[model samples]
Target chain A: MDVKTRKITGQVIFVLLALYLDGLMKWAFLNNMNTGEVMLIPQLMLMVLVMLSMRISDRRQLITYGIVFGLIYDSYYFGMIGLYTVLLPLAMVGVDHYKFLFVKANMGYEISIYFLALTFMQSGIYILERLLQQTKVDTMDFITFTLGPTLLWNMIVFFILYIPLANLSDWLVKYRRDK
Target chain B: MQKFFSNKKLIILMLIIIVTFGLLAVSVNIKDKKSTPPVIQQVGNDTVSIVGGIFAYPTNAVKNASSEFSDLYNTYTENRRLKSKIGELAQNQAKLKVVQEENKKLKDELKLNATLTDYTFVNASVLSRSPSSWQSYLTINRGQTSGLKKNMPVMSGKGLIGRIIEVNKISSKVELISTDNELNDKFASEIQSDNKNVTGIVSKYDSDSGDLVMENVTSTKDVKKGQKVITSGLGGLTPRGLYIGKVSAIKKDNYGMTNSVYITPAAELRNFTVVTVIKSSVSGEE
Candidate 1:
């Protein structure tokens, strides 16, 4: 394959791996089985998406990644289409829109961006599911139990995986020297 | 009218809102009412699950190894406890087999093909679980091709775990019993107490204490702390005698009018890499 094709392929594979890791991590570790009250959902896919959104300057590509992966995620995992399919694109676009403020991406900015994206995506999902009558968890309970723990856990994971993830995402989005 | 329609962003925003609600409403309706999702969605899910198996297998292998390691740690005590129960277990097994044979003969004499309690199971390996907060679903490898149907109760090695909520071509989603969703978790359950069978619905999950909330019990007076709870088969989709859990505690509603039995679920709800989907022999009101 050509260099551009190779880069795009690498990016797709990385995102796919992240997506799979999200589910595996939940199944293997963060299932909240022992402590049923506090739920910690791994947002590795969202973290990778946020990183890519910041790096990939093309708005249309970011939105496409959002909607497509969102659909796959919703279909395969959530069993609902609209939750991720719409909100993911919105999150990506939001990241892409605000990323211009940062002349150069740094750990601080990337981490905060991921944090915001995670919060927005998760809260959006909660609200939509609530309205759809998919979940009966009250607001306070949701925030304290689900949102609080998920954010903390994912943030810690993001911090730990930041260097490698950021570098990998940078390489995936960077243009070829030959081009 | 032309000028009003010329605002591209406004039109796009309106379209997006309409599409969002429209998609959400339609998908939810289809999931609740239909046996399977749309063809496109089924194909998408099946394809994704096919690829997901590659990652799931290795992870599940590692999970199994870890669980085995933990089991090894407790083997000495567990072996002693198990040895004490072995004689009783063998006796119960022989008695159960004889009773099952008798029940089969009686059913044959009556020409009863199937009943609410008659069920067969298909084992499916764990693929992956949903990472969402509300929709606590587990994707298993088996699907409609394996006679899996929507709302069929699933079990882990220990006991009842959940039910199949969505069935695709070659994959399906099991909504666990512990989910906060009201419509999906209700199971017709009963407790076997001395002299009587008190029936109730396992309708809610208490996440705080990790107990299932069984409501509408005839009498909480007879429900002891250690009484075993099982499915009553009142609901046609689920078969009778599926072990749910033990009665942990009984609590009254705020009004003191009704009682809810808190059950400690039998299934660990984790550490299992495979699940069994119970397909009832008798077709109910579905």
Candidate 2:
């Protein structure tokens, strides 16, 4: 195939890897079933999606990726439909909208954007689940136990994985720049 | 109308919000009300799970190897403790064999076909556990194709772990017993004592201390710590004599109106990668 098609395929595979890694990481390491109140949800897929959105300039492409992958994510992992299906596209669009403010996608800007996106998506989920009566956790307990630990853990992971992920996403989007 | 139609971004934003809540509400209801999800969803889940098994198997292997290393660390003490019980276990096995034979003969004479304790199991390796906080579900490889059904009790190496909440064509989801959800976590259980059995619903999970809280108990007077707890089979779907846990402590609710028996679950909940889905021989009311 052509270079552009190959590059797009690489991007999809990269995001898919991140998606699987989210569930596997939770199952392997963060499986705190019995002992602790603190919960850490791995959002590696969001991290990859944000990185790709910053690089790929097309708005429609971003939304499409968001919806398709989000549907798969929700169906396979969450066993529910709309949480990721809606929030993911919104988060991607939000990233794409603000991306032009930065001249170059550096670590600082990308990490901050990811942090914002993660916060928005997670809080959106909590609010929606609360409204649906799916979860009864009060606001204070959710903030302290689930949200706090999740942010800290994911931030550390983003920091550790920043260099490779940034370089990979840059390579995946470089074909458009060459054209 | 013209002014409102001119703002495309606003229209899209409103559409997204409306669709979001609409999809969430409908799917949640379907999940609660339906025995199986829609066929298209089942196909999607089965495809994802099949691919997931490729990744899950290797991770499970690594997990098993690591756990084996830890097991080696405790081998000496475990061996010593187990050695003393070997003789007793052998004698119990012989006695149990004779009793089972006599019981089978008696049942045949009485024309009884199946009992609550009769169950068959399908073993499934867990593919992944949901990262969500409230939904503590594990996706397993076996599903409707394996004759698995919803609400069937799941067990690990030690004891009961959870129940099947959703079944797809080739994969299913097991909702763990530790989930605090009000609708799905209840298991009818009874404390086994020498004289009298105290029956109760193993309903709530106390996340603070990681203990299962049993409520609606008939009497706490006969309940005692260190007693065994098992499924009483009073409820439909689950079979009798499935090991639940040991009675850890008894406490009163905040209102102090009733007593709750707390059980320390026998299943490790974190360590195992495979689960057994028990199919009761005598199906209860649908």
Query: Could you say which candidate leads in lDDT?
Result: 2
Evaluate residue A124 in candidate 1 and report its C-alpha lDDT on the 0 to 100 scale.
Answer: 90
Q: Write model 1 residue lDDT over B85-163, tens digit each, in one string.
A: 9999999999999999999999999999998788899999999999988788999999989989899999999999999
TM-score per candidate, chains pooled: 0.96, 0.98
Regions more than 4 Å wrong, model 1: A177-179, B1-3
Span of 10 residues, lowest total lDDT, candidate 2 chain A? A170-179
TM-score of 2: 0.98
Residue pairs clashing, model 2: none
Question: Whose DockQ is greatest here?
Answer: 2
lDDT of each: 0.90, 0.92
Model 1 TM: 0.96
lDDT of 2 by residue, A1-179 (tens): 78988988999889888887888888887899986788899999999999999988899999999999999998988788999999999999999988889998799999899999999999999999999898999999999999989999999999999999999898899864464
Give per-residue lDDT, candidate 1, residue A148.
Answer: 95
Cα distance off (Å), candidate 2, residue B119? 0.2
